[model samples]
Target: MKKKLIQYSDGYLNRVPILQFILVTLLFPLWGAAASLNEILITQFKVVFELSDFATAFVQSAFYGGYFLIAIPAATVIKKTSYRVAIIIGLLLYIIGCYLFFPASNMATYGMFLVAIFGIAIGLSFLETSANTYATMLGPKESATRRINLSQLFNPIGNIVGIILGKYFVFTDGASLESQLAGMTPAEAEVFSQEMLQRTLVPYQFILIILLVVLLMFLFVKFPKTKPETSKNVKNKVNLGETLKYLSKNNPFKKGILAQFIYMALQTTVWSFTIRLALEINPNINERFASNFMIYSFVAFFVGRLIANVLMTKFKPTFVLTIYGIIGVAALTYTAFVPNMTAVYGAIFVSVLFGPCWPTIYGRTLETVDDKYRETAGAILVMAIIGGAVGPVVQGFFSDMFGSLQLSFIIPMLFFLYLAIYFLSENKNDSHVKEESKIA
Candidate 1:
């Protein structure tokens, strides 16, 4: 029986259309790269615009705020058209957003940059809403979580690349901007700020060219028709009120949304402030040099995702998630209390713990949802990414209030604790359900 189960799993995997799967999986890294760049942007923008920590966090607020606003509309497009159509639309929006960077840089306007970031996020919202749900439907239901986890593995690769680009192409080598500004004439400062803003646009230029190529691929390449079992017909128009009413009572799905919200908050806060925390601990390093730690963190995140893929094949995803959550909470706790270079390393280690939570919670949440509701449900879940927007601002507020980046980490620690408890409860419920099934 064990051998037969293995064969069944293999057969389900084999049935997946490799080309379409590859194309959809490609999207994972693109968004990963985009998100990683945001962390870099927070630091860069802080220096460029002479903004406060709370003001810098508005970068995430604008970016993820786009996700919250566009998600439901993206879902509506999917229901009205097809996943292919929605994906193409998303790519178009992403391309347009990238182009906005040119005007933003030329004008040297921080608000324009925020507008550009918002556009890019809207595009990402569409891609995530389509790609995540589409990945689950690619093969058999039994392997859904594993398949999504496998695809998400590429996301960290994108993250690593984004950090590398920021470290190399974006960050300038010199005295800190604040120090330089204190001595410079206002005219010199304006010139220096414009130069810095132009440098920030370099990565986006590279991103725009790549997005154009990907957009072409999506436009011309014929995606395989979804199997009938997974396809929706025209009769199944979405009713927002009814969908919300149904989902309101779904305990697991609701918990998953909450988990995702808290997880995003934790993730954004940790990455957004890693450099700030590093500088606080050791004042000697430049922003460029400090970014090396962020790179290390992404590498750890990549490694963690690889490990998670293997673990989930043999163990339940919630069990793996619960374990990671506990470790994450412990690590953040140490980081908060220690306030040393060792604590910095501990904070970076939290990335490994975070690597798997997004996909695991996402897949598990959708598992409880009916197929008809999957697209809209996925949209609502993606909407929870607003936590990314909200978390950093709150952390920034705390950082400013207490004047301690270290103390602010307590916020994420609590968030991690919530995830650990959530998944532990889920694991118990899953076991209870299995035991009852056996008894019957």
Candidate 2:
């Protein structure tokens, strides 16, 4: 099975220009890192700005709000132009957003920082729409899910590194800096807070330089002008209204959208508040210590993705998704009720279960939709990432009201339950369609 999967990957790689493939794959981790940094931002901003839990979660709202607002526009851009142009546009916006952090810090306003994050997220929306849809076009239908999963393997790797970056530079240093200011006068503490806020500027500046280089690479790289897999009937002028009309008949695709919506919501809620849950449940854990645990969670997430990659070659992608979703529901349900260190570990375990859900569902959605509509479909699903914007704030509100971070996990538990149902229903509907076609 493993050999066959490798052969499939190699076959696709052989078909595409190797450098173009490599360049596209490089984007997997970049956006993953950018998204994962929000975890640290949630924790850091809460402390740095003295924000309430609800207010701090606005970071996610602003970040994913960009996705909500910009995904369709990005789709329109890709529809009118080419994926390469869209990728270059995404990279430029990402770089601009990263650079904006410097001015935001200098201004010492949280709202300014949110504007920066929003800009960065718009870039991510474009990249996801282009890259994910492009990945599906690289291989035959049978292996599309595995191909995306293989590319997505780097996402967790980048997440692990992002967590590490947050640990060493943002969370740890901020904690130490805060401790230093505890003994100082209010004036001195204010000065120290400004200095600490400035620490964020360095990492984003480095990110800006890296994105600029990637942008240049994309500018010069030659991507395949068309894929054999894309339907020749696909018009350059894709009509959004017509696409929606077609999609209304696509039952599996609709379910896939729901699953993606809930999946993203659960993912952002669990991760965005992990540090808060950790400190609340575990007496020995501080903010810095909990940040390390977040890294550990990503380690589990990476391992889960690796295992899922292997499992995809052996079993159906939907089967794997269903299994993971079931486990995730159980674990998150346990986490919500337990309210202890065990629950903390359970939350991490559930995160591992979520690792494969994103890529698998995305791959399956592309497979089910017509090639003509895949790009627009991808954008609509990325727009569903607004669930990330919505879920965290809801969870934050619950946590603030109830004063129990652990119990607030009920929000994500419900999300996982929705996913398990969607997965089963999608598979059942597919089987029914196949059976009816065979009879005909």
Candidate 3:
């Protein structure tokens, strides 16, 4: 069949970019299942199992934990297969993860819950690896920046729906604590708490069904073709050893990847503890309702990326990433020191600042690389994202023995301090105006 091509705003973005957009958009609901499911999962732990902030972060640790196990294997699969095949495999694993939650929740075993989440995250690992590569290959190679930005809409959109669903399910917010305290016995209050947390099933099952349907839909969808050169052609196309040599010598790229990895660790660590931190902020804060606030926190991420897309046209991507890294330092500081719900809420807005870091940091890293190695470079980038898994786990361990989840966030913040240095070096010696003009 002849492929239907649609042109994008940038001249290079023409030809079926819409298909990529549609596929990327699916990330919303997939991630939504993750984000939304998190609220109830964590809340139930805190109420039933009486978990600490450190212990609670384990929930996210379990999720990102899959990335570590699956990262390399998923990349190998992608290298061997087409993007569509990899994605299909990923979505299938995710559905299994979702269904696993049924038995976990039914058994009321925290271990089971973690196992299920790990399964889902494994699926996500494949999705992350494939979808990003697909997006990059979709349009004019020169217009890669524009295409990546446009594709990122899925990130925040999924987060938004995830927030809403997470909040709606976990937060049973009826009868203020004061009112309940005045009327009910201690035993009665505990029962109410149990009932409130169990309500998570309402949304978890709903999204799980949506994920199943979506997975089936993608199976039918005709994703555009993208293939890595195979066998004899592979040697002629690109050599992995040479690609590694090129990436290794690239100082800015090396530092940038390290910076990005650290930045993500810090970001994930703080966010994993966000729910507990919100409650710490307001004694009256509903643990169930905390997911709703998280929804608001994620808005900054969405809005920040959207704004960056517009401003990237005017500003250099590296400069933008550097500024965001610096702002990330400031936001982490604010989040660390502040005790108010409003301050924590404001701190989440930093996601906007951070929203551009991963992609832009990546773009800057590859700025020096020849485009032939882009696929290999992408696998390395996914490894960089694995820092998210590692960093959060470290923070969670701290939270486990320590009393403060907020304070644990500082550990990851240290990584961002290094990221600032990486950004600073990206455009040294040259005038900022000249750099922007050159890229423009």
Candidate 4:
């Protein structure tokens, strides 16, 4: 079964979807591990570069900006290149992003930091576009959501661990580090900041080393590379018209994408606003509290992903999505309007509903298209991450306009409301009930 998974091009892959899910899942934790990185990075940029809070936030905006621009192109690369090669390219890009920090710190330029984040986001975009589609391929069409959800378990778990490590080692606040940077001349600041960020090189180098070993293993490893189905219900050829036509014609597909777009939009808004909300409660929030929030957010992500993995085995992803969406609406509303940490924690629960939806939606897109169009479907699915860039920026804009961070979350709340409606409608039809991932 494991051997079959490594070679998914052949029909034999369907024989062991779980193993396929498992193997691709190896990439999921890296997703979570990267979560806290944004918050830590933004904070660090402000202190070392002596930039305003808004400027530091814009650095994050730049990363998402790069993510938006790079996603479709990366997807195109994946379609043309093999998944294995694409994964390697993504890792190389990630390494370059990390390495750039050395030079960026040396320059002590906020712009350089943004450039590095941009590089990292681009790499992540590539990784996601390729890996998500690969994960969906690991199961039956009807059960694809469950399979993808199971595959995403490690992403959140990785996120939790990453938050802790990033907090402790990457950008944890220190009067010493802060004072050291302050005392340095611009050139000295550059040197000091570079020195501090250079510490991240150790982790990045370790990852590179591990991946090198893994690459050698891949050389020895035999994974299947099956061609998409020739006689699929849809044509083998993919063009703009066909992609658009397919999406327009399929009700479930159209509904799925709508929900996906909005869901992503909402998720981005929540996280973006969470930072302000945290600061509002305590004006003097240091690196320590921010790290805690990162950890808390990751915990929510972990619980959410883990829950989806388990429930996918027993309940439909559609059902799970609906319940979570409604609950998410409640959570977001309370987080925005309610005034206490207890109420704010409700927002955290929203992560549970959210964590599983991205993969679930993409899995649905797979069902909407013929196997021949899997690559395109994957591209569109991942392209939806542009919502991360767009939604957060919009939230930030509204926060600036409204002079209140809490109100900006309304955007995500509304998006989830639409998703909730779609889920309810689908569940009522009972037309697409399917098997789920059982490894949970």
Candidate 5:
């Protein structure tokens, strides 16, 4: 008799739905481009609005604040509905937010631009909450970390594209906008400000078109139903009180939340200040030239992610993460104490070290979580992204208080140090658990 074949419901052998996984992975870069573009906006807005460093930092504050506020609601949406539906909702919010940029530019209102950014972030929050959790569910639990890291590999591609867009389109190559505004008559300055604001909108307009195409793709694609969606139990409703209590007891998840928060803060603060630091260190370069360093940083980030993907397959994710974290702390320490062009390079190289920290923390955190609580756990993790909002502002404050941008590098250095230690401790805990299990 011929051997019988086993049938899988979701996909081949119930393995990863390759096409669906690709589509979901694409979401990483989309949000990444948006996030990195904010770095350019920070530089542009500071000059255009004649704002202080602290004021300019509000750009990130508004953007990530949206993530913090909407994360739980987004998780709830995923629990109640499906990841596809939540992603569609996210895309819609992203589209709406992109559209608002036009009106914001036309009105020449900074506040309106912030509102637009917040809307985009809300969309991003939903996408991140859903896409991240969904990616983990795409394969076996054992490979989840590697799988999420693979998806995140595309993120730096988006970051690179974003920086390139800003470098070429958003930033002007000439006398600084501040200098140009100083030379203009009052009426000319108002007209010029409007013109510059409109120019800044160009990249967003392009991104909007891309978002629309992706949205359509997402709308048409049939995603595999994962555990959360496949369940028929009525008890799946997300109870914030109970969920919080459960997650609170999970030591790894709690620590992961804290680590994610610090990682975001470090990432945002580092990128936001990259151009500023370059300009400060190399006073002759324009913003356009300064942006090249940011691009280099993004490239380093991409390379680091690729390397981490390989490394994680061979070593424990926590062990690899610990090493990366140590190197990041060392790099940033050099960056803080030594305010030279080489130090700036050190700051740029830190991006490579940072590449794996987020996904590693995220994947490891969720590993300890029950499948039933995964969506809520993922949402809370995304909410930790509020660190992005808070970090830059804190760095800006330090820069303003001390009248030294380089000294502000100390903040991220300390943050990196904490990550190194946190993961080191986690490694010890994992070993202990394994020993206990073996003994039993």
Candidate 6:
């Protein structure tokens, strides 16, 4: 029976239903743009609202927290219903969240913005949980990672666009908002703050329109349903105790979750503070100029995906992951010790290593788990994205305590060190499973 499924999947993968694949890939950039735009919000809100580093870090907390909160439930939904239903639900939530930004800006409260971000995150969580599984299912198991990487290549494109929009629309000025506000009187500052908050509405309003269009398209388009044999027609019952028992015995799965948590934390902290790191190195640099560093990171990320795709073809994903982890440690060493422009560029350079970590980890772990448990496995991994929420706050706390964003990079350095250890450990155990490594 399994052999028959494999033969069927090979035929399905050969042709790969081009139009359906393109439609699914189209959803990739939307959430990517939403997630990347958050860095701009962190910077803008910090100054406009007079927030501490720790307080500003809550922007990430609220954003990724939504993912942690929704991932497990979304997994159940996908397992119980269908991927298409999950995606539609996700899109609707995204639309509501994007439209809420208008009222959130009017309310002009940080908490309201957090609520809006949380709503958007709920949508993203749903989309990501369903979309990732769907993408992998679209092709043969051997080419699953390759297919996911091809689709994910668009993610950084969205990040670049988000950064550009943030540079022009959200932040809008060359200098820091604080610096500009310094010249304003109390009355003028109030007006300026309101106007700055209002500026956020434009991009989010545009996002709302885009989400609505995507939602309608998905509703109308007929997606090829390639439901997993394990999940299809199975009764949906989320037994936490059973899931926990299964995970506890699966060492590779456990390690993969830890690696994912660390990777997410590292990625979120690095991107969230890249601007601050740049400004620390050059205080005269404007917010718009500093944001260009983010564009560089995303560009590196895009390029890294392209390169990693090729590398994965020739080597084991675990082997390549270990090598990237080593490079990350070296780059982060420069970031932590050197406080010059060289260190800031080193920070940007780390994105190349960071780029493939998530997908690699996802692919690696998906291979480790039993077919019956894959959906739950994906959720647990996504839930581990809470690392993004927790990591930045820790880094932000360190930044505030040490009064140096450069020094705070030590947090991410430690994260990369753990990833190196995890990947190397996996590589050693993979000695007998060369075929598994290649596919992973």
TM-score of 6: 0.93
Q: Per-residue lDDT for 26-54 in model 2, tens only?
A: 89888878888888888778777888888
lDDT of 4 by residue, 207-326 (tens): 455445544543454454444644454446576567667766877766666677677677766665564466565555555555677567768887877877778679866787789888
Q: What is the lDDT of residue 149 in candidate 5?
A: 88
Model 1 stretches with alpha carbons more than 4 Å out: 1-14, 225-238
**Model 2, which residues run further than 4 Å from truth?**
1-14, 173-184, 227-238, 433-440
User: How would you encode candidate 5's per-residue C-alpha lDDT over 1-440 as one tens digit per residue?
Assistant: 43333223331224677788999999999999999999999998988888878888999999999999999999889877788999999999988988888899888878999999999999999999999988887766667777888999999999999899999988888877777888999999989888888887888888988898999999898876575433455665457788899999998788889999999999999999989888888777788988899999999999998888888779887898899888898899899888689988998999999889888889888888876778889999999999999999999999998898888999999899998999999888889989999999
Sort the predicted structures by TM-score, highest score first: 5, 1, 6, 2, 3, 4
Residue 341 in model 1: lDDT: 87
Candidate 6 residues lying further than 4 Å off, grouped into runs, are 1-15, 230-241, 435-440
Superposition TM-score, candidate 3 onto the true structure = 0.84
Would you list the rank order by lDDT, best first? 5, 1, 6, 2, 3, 4
Which candidate, 4 or 5, would have the higher TM-score against the true structure?
5
Tell me which residue pairs clash in candidate 3.
Answer: 6-16, 28-158, 54-399, 54-400, 171-288
Best model per TM-score = 5
Please provide TM-scores, in order, for all candidate models, with all chains considered together. Answer: 0.94, 0.90, 0.84, 0.82, 0.94, 0.93
Candidate 5: where is the Cα deviation over 4 Å?
1-13, 229-238
In candidate 6, position 194 carries an lDDT of 93
Clashing pairs in 6: none
In candidate 4, residue 73 scores what lDDT?
73
* TM-score of model number 5: 0.94
Q: Which numbered prediction scores highest in lDDT against the true structure?
A: 5
